[model samples]
Target chain A: MKKRYLAGAAIAAAAALALAGCAGTAGGGSSSSTKTLTLAEAQKATSADDFGGMDGLVAAANAEGHLNVITLPPSWANYGQIIQGFEKKYPKIKINSANPDGSSADEVAAAKAQKGQSTAPDVFDIGTAVMNQNLDLFAPYKVQSWNDIPADYKDADGLWYYDYTGLMSVGYDTKKFPNGVKKIDDLLGSDFKNSVAIKGDPTQANEAASAVYMAALQSGGSADDIQPGIDFFQKLKQSGNFLSTLPTQATVASGETPVVIQWSFNNVAWGPAAGSAGNPNWKTVVLPGAGLGSYYNQTINADAPNPAAARLWEEYIYTPAVQNLYLAAGAYPAQLAAMEKAKTVDAATLSKVGAAPKDFVQLTADQATKAASLLSAKWAAAVG
Target chain B: MTALASNHGAGATPRRRGARPPRRPGTGWIGLIPFSVYAILFLGIPAVLAIASGFFTSAGAFTISNFSAFGDPVILKDLVGSLGLSAASAILGAVIGALVCYAMLGMNPDGWLRTIVDSASSVLAQFGGVMLAFAFIATVGNQGLIIVIAKQLFGDSALSSPIYTVPGLTLVYLYFEIPLMVLTFMPALEALKPAWGEAVATLGGSRWTYWRQVGFPILAPAFFGCMILLFANAFSSFATAAALISQGGIWPLDIQRALTSETVVGHENEAGVIALGMIVVMVVLMSAYGVLQRRAARWGS
Candidate 1:
């Protein structure tokens, strides 16, 4: 009996050791395929380097046959339709979208964590503030339509470029607020008590951060200063109108969050969805005084697993067809001006977006970075 | 094992007649090889790296600024909040859970009701994080069923604070904490033999006196051990709170902020420092638990 027990213990221990050894060996394998075609060099490629045209680049991407995208919510900016169009265009290359509900910070963290792994994100759709913070993690690659993109929109080295932009707006349930919130100050009324909410933590989420910046703009702060925005939230909290919880469609329909400060595109898209989900009175309005617009950027991960496919994705997103999809979803596509000039934009889609406030102020990279830092340092104290 | 023990027993009888030789050192250590290897790979390496990073700069130079950053008032507030939340939840869970266990003791242990409650407690204790937070929100949130019903009945706002606040969070935590308490404290309750009660009854001692003298004394260490476990569990928990509260002004949230907050540049080391602080707290609590558990083991045996 003693010998049998000893043998059983030994076998279990040996099996565990064997499993550990197997796991170790498994991870160290699978990174040794030598490619005659390297995607890292594609960043510096001209027409000649890619066999003289866009056709050659397409062939290369098709050969690779895979793309890993992170943080592309299907509802946000009509990524669902854009992704479908891309897949339909590139039948050979498969797209693996990860964490559709994850925030911008989660995307950057995944890029950092999975740096050299085969599972690393090939493409990223994140806030410009996040893109600037993690610039070293991006590989410089300009699409074929790079010339049409505004100079202010794209990085000089082509590490990152604007995809679509949205204005910050206030959304409210029509039934709850019979007298609608037409301005930022209207949100401070006792009727809106404990009803105002943003998407998520401003320090981590771009939409919420932009909302704060818009509030700052409305409350005497310029593009460079965000203190007024924090103070605005503080006063809102003091007035018992601020709710720290993230406002989701469910929360909106449930009447828990009747007022939300979010991006115009999100508000526009979510309003109808919330209406369909039993809250028919959902309405959105862009605040005239707080006309601040922010754009999300597109970039290729520095160590993307499917580099060719990533570059192809970047090329595809900036095209007229995809840009129109963005516009139809209520976001102002980055290539809107170029498409308008070329008359390649779908007029019907342009009409659907209607008109947004034109007096919007754009933040420089430095100003955004400063504002993010100040908000991160002060937001908790202000709201708490 | 019996054959080896017999052989050893035979050898020891003769050895006992004279002087026993010192045992070989490696012989005793061989049994621990598997556990030691597992710990070194998983716990030991990560813990060492986390501690080392807390003392280093992003460029890998030695620095104490990471530790000093804890002096920030926000960070201090988070620490206090985390401690207060954990303590409140743990104490509440322990008292309520202990009462539940005592109630179970009066029921027939083999009955279907006891069996169902026992199984439910086991399952519920582990049911927390995102799903649990959402569950509470659906039940007691601003537009929750209970709130809606109460509003109709009273013709006014029934609950003053929303479910996302600290008080609301404590209420949500109690949902899991009470069940966890029942599961942990039930075994200690079961260890209380009927003979102890019978002996007190024969001695003409009242029920209250019997419990005061025998029941409470025997269960005290186990109760304390469970409370510490609950405290540590609540202190380290992040997902439930993260899902509920968007702006984290608590320790676990601060730790998450240290890791994921983009505004604070080079916060990875600061995260390591915060993580190290959490580890220190957990270690201290666990050590106390370990001592209490050992003390309780005597009564259990």
Candidate 2:
């Protein structure tokens, strides 16, 4: 028995050493390929709600001198964009940033583990579901533009608020949506049945979850009742038109999946980029309809070790000029006035990517949860 | 074997009473302390936490709800699916490994066969996760090397398909498992002497007679042991499945199911339940083999 145990121990040690070595050598984001936000992409805020309380927060945070913000992306896409512009504006603070994988529950657990310590993130760009789950960890503060956000979106206690959303912009082979259908009903036609695609793992995504929430709302059930959402996938499955997974960019332009339920910016980035050779055939199709979008939000960590840097980053990312950088990069910005002023979210881009006016299916926390569960199960069944 | 126990006094007392050879002093045992320490830290602590947590949280009451969640069809299906795949991989691995071992044994020891087995086993052992995925894709994808070659040979209809299906997943797994199997079972084969086969053959015995009397009796325990190891390795793995699924996260779907569960509270239960069963099964098989090995030694003496 001792000999056997010893043998198992030896095997385990050798394996652990190999795994540790492999892990160190691969996949970690220490390269120039790592994404960072810059001041050049920082758009200025125009809506009165955005700049409202930022100055005080920035001043408070700056007195501390150093800031460490650990948040997830879309915000990571340009946390530095509008942020460093503020650093240029202030010149008193130093910042460190870490963008953990958004889909990892472990990363969220790690942040919870470090909540009160110096290592805790000063800001959290959390998902809708988790933002509410860890609300207690944050130190709540209402920003200047707090009122511009709907009461339902921001925490009344001011722990966190909506920063931006990754709505499902309908993408189609412009070759197929020739007249360019711009509504949810537009997707039901024969031309787009098997052609539409969805990201495979919707359970981990805020946007995908929100889409199901939208479907429940649009089809007459409250978001709290997600039977409609389940039925939605079931119908798609029975129709034999369900293409459940779409690669981020490669599949979109290839016309394999003509319509993709994807982020606005991914479509914006690749919509009509110089194709691999001459020009790719497909184009983007943005549809405006009820229950067709998901919002990826940014929220400040209330108990930030570096509240100044967190606040500074908040102000930096909310500006119009910087917001346009995101627009240019392929994401829709939260600050509408800034985007309008910059005139970068072009009509062509909007037609290809933005949600149509009057189609928002706003949901509360309880409703979002119920919708997430029902839709995820139906999605599993659908994929199966 | 049953008749032998009645005659235990023949060799049993002498063996039991005789002064056993002192274990080779410092025969690699001291080199194992770090390994023991690691097992306690990683395998021991996590297992303890999991079992303890299943009973009660640090703060309060006990709950059997984690086990109850297995009532869900999805959970049960994942458990069964994982077992099925692991068993399949293990059997597949053992067969391929045995065949390769037999083939290599017949060849000259210093020949090309040895070189091929050496390099191939090492390379296949290292092939995992994304690199494994890429290798399969390069073989069977729409734009893969084989598909292109086949298209020129056959036609465009060949590209209109999925080479990454469930069958394809099993094939990819076999690619690695067969090599690892070779790595695991090769030592026993190397230890085997040609004299055993020739001696039995000299008595005018047929091949099957020799194998039954000499080959399998000697190597059956080793091959079976290695098969169980293969099953355990593949069963516990998450990454290869994660990479292979069609934009999906993991195969057996259990790993992804575990990851996406809102509460981690019940995850260990479902995964641990299947894993714990595999461990129990493996322990039983190995124990039985150990007993058989003792019986075989007694018979040989």
* Residue lDDT tens for model 1, A104-143: 7778877876676556788998876666767888888878
User: In candidate 2, which residue ranges exceed 4 Å CA deviation?
Assistant: A1-100, A104-107, A116-119, A172-197, A210-246, A250-259, A270-282, A325-334, A337-356, A376-378, B1-20, B23-30, B50-62, B148-167, B246-256, B259-301
Q: Tell me how far the alpha carbon of residue B211 in candidate 2 is from the true structure, in angstroms, after superposition.
A: 2.8
User: How many clashes in each candidate?
Assistant: 2, 30
In candidate 2 the C-alpha lDDT for residue A113 amounts to: 50
lDDT of 1 by residue, B34-75 (tens): 868877776678778877888998667999899976887778
Candidate 2 positional error at B266, Å: 9.5
In model 2, the Cα lDDT at residue A309 comes to 59
Lowest lDDT block of 10, candidate 1 chain B: B6-15
Docking class of 1: acceptable
